[model samples]
Target: MSVSEQFVGGDGVISTPIATGVGTGEKAEVIGHRTADAKPSGEYASILADTPLQADEAGVASRGMYSPLTSLCNEPRFATMRRGHKVMVGQNGWLERPGSIAKKPEQPKKAGFFDSLKRIAKEVADATEMKSSRRVKGGERGRASSRVRISLDPREQSLLYCELEFLLTSALDCYINSQFNAGRLDADKYKKVVDAWHQKGRPKVVGFRYDLETQLDLVFLHMKDFRFYGDRASVPAAISGILEAMRVNARALRVRTFCQPDSVMAKQLLDSQSLLNLLGSAEQRQIQLAEVVQFFKIVLEREHKLQRTEEVRGLPQ
Candidate 1:
C-alpha cells in the first residue's frame, strides 16, 4: 500500500498529488488539477528527486520537483525558440519578440549601351538643325539689309538729269573736236565752247568763285539720281560707251597727232578719261559716290591749286 500526499503546486490554484512508498526502479504516479482548464488532468509521470522547495519574494514557491527540460522550456530565452521567431533587445535591456522586418524594394534596371548612343545621336541632330535654322535666318536678314532703297525729290532729280546731259554733250563735243581738227587742237576754242554750254538756261554772272564743293556738286549730282532710281548698273554702261566713242575718234584722227604727249589739251583729255574710269571702277566695287567725290576734290585742290579768280572746270568739261 502507498500513502498519498496532497499539496498546492507553484501556481496557487493547481493541486498536485504525490505517492510515496514506491519500489525502487518504479515511478510514482502524480495527478495534477489545472485551474486554467475545466477538468482535472494527468500526464505521463517521471521520477523526480526529493529536492527542498523555497518561496521567492513574491510568496510563490519555486518549482523544485519539475524536470530540468520543463524548467528550460519555461526560461525567457527558450520561450520564443520556435521556427521563424525573432528575439531582439528592447528598451531598458528587456527581451522583445517582434514580427519580421520588411525587405527593401529592388533597384531599377540600368540603361543599355545602344540606348545611350541613340540618345546622344538625337541630341546632336537637334543641335545641328537649330544651327542651320539660325544660319538661314541670318542669311535672309543680310539679303534684306543689302537691298536698301534711296529716296529723292523731283527738283533734285531734274538737276541731276540736266547735269548728266551736259556732261554727255561736252564729252561728245570734245571727241568730235579731237576727230575734226587733229592738227590744230585750239585750247581757247575748247574752253569757250564748254563755258557757253554751262551758261545755258542760267543767269549770266560776270565772275564767281567756283570752289571744290561747287565742282563736286555739279559733277556727282548725276550719281545721286542713279542711286535713287536703283539704276547704278547703267553708269558703267554709259562710261563704256563714251570711252568707246573717244577711242574711235582718236583712231580716226591718228592717236599720235591728236593727243600730243607734251600738250595741255592731251593732259586734260587723259585726266578726264582717268576720272571716268575711276568712277566706273568705284561703282563696280560698290564704293559710296560721296567718298569718291571727296577724294577727287582733295586731288583737284592739291594739283590745280585753283584761286578765287579761276572758274571750277569740272572733270569731263
Candidate 2:
C-alpha cells in the first residue's frame, strides 16, 4: 500500500506494529506519541489536550525556557498552582511601551547646576546613619517633583531586538519564579526595575549604517512606543538620550547626522522650543509625556510636603 493509503485500517495501523495481530491488521489511528505513534488518534487527542482538570501543556517554548508546571490533580485537587505553566515565546529584554506627543506642563527645571550632586547628597543624608532623627530638621520648603530624569550613554540606547524578543522568555521565567501566580508581572514594577538596570542606553546603533533619519526615527520610536515617561523633565532627557545615541551611532556606523544636535550645548537648547518641537514631531511621543509630567508634578509636591512635615518634627543635620 502507498504511504497515504497504507495508514488505513479499522484498528488504525498502517505501518509495522509491535503487536502484529492485535491492531496491525487494522489501521494506524495516530501519527506520533510520547514513545511512538502506536496509540490511536482518538485516544491520543484526549491525552495531549489541555482540559479544565489538567492545566499544563507538555511542550516547551522555542528557547526551551517555558513550560507549564501544571499537575493533573495537584496532590488532591489543584495544589495551590503556584508554579504555573511556562511558555517561553522568545528570549529576554525590553519591550517599548506606548507613548504620546502631547503638550508638557509648565514647571521650573530641577536645578541650574550641580543637579545630580545635590539630589544624591539629600538621598544620602536621608538614608545615612550619620544623621540622627533627634538632630534632624523638620518642615522645610515644599518641592515639586516636576519630572523624572534618567541618563544613559550616547550610543545604541535600545536593547537588541533579539534580546527584546527574549524579554518574553525572561518575563515568563520571571513569572514562573515570582511569588505572584497571577500569570502576568506588574508592568510598573517591571519598567522600574528594567529602566533602573538599563545600561549602554543611547541613541546611536553602533556598527549599523542605516539612514540617519531612519535611525533617528527609531530613537523616537522608543520614546513614542517603547520607553515609559513620567513627566515634562523626562521628555527632555529622553530627547537628549535619543539624540546623543543617534550621534554616537553615526560616528561608529559611518552614518551622517547621527550625533547629538547643536542643541545639546545647554540644558535647554539655544532654540529650545524649536528643538523640542522638532524631536516631538519626529518621535510623535509628545502627547503622553505632557500628561505624565503634569501628573508627576502633583506627586512631587506631595513628597515635598511630607519631607517638610518630617523636618518640622525634628532638628537639622
Against the reference, the lDDT scores of all candidates come to: 0.30, 0.28
- Once superposed on the true structure, which residue ranges of model 2 sit more than 4 Å away at CA? 1-214, 217-242, 245-276, 280-285, 315-317
Cand. 1 Cα-lDDT: 0.30
Q: Over the stretch 1-317, how does candidate 1's per-residue lDDT look in tens digits? A: 11112123333332122223332323333442222212222221221123221111111122222222334334543343346644456543246435633465799897664344334334433433332232223356655532221111243223322332233333333322222122122223323433543566433211111222232232332332222112333566654444454444334333223222112222223333343343332221112222222222232232223321243544320
User: What is the per-residue lDDT of model 2 for residues 230-252, given as tens digits with 9 covering 90 to 100?
Assistant: 23435756566646654444344
In TM-score terms, candidate 2 sits at 0.20
Clashing pairs in 1: none
Segments in model 1 whose C-alpha atoms lie over 4 Å from true places: 1-146, 183-317
- What count of clashes does model 1 give? 0
Q: In angstroms, give how far residue 245 of model 2 lies from its true place.
A: 7.2
TM-score of each: 0.18, 0.20
TM-score of 1: 0.18
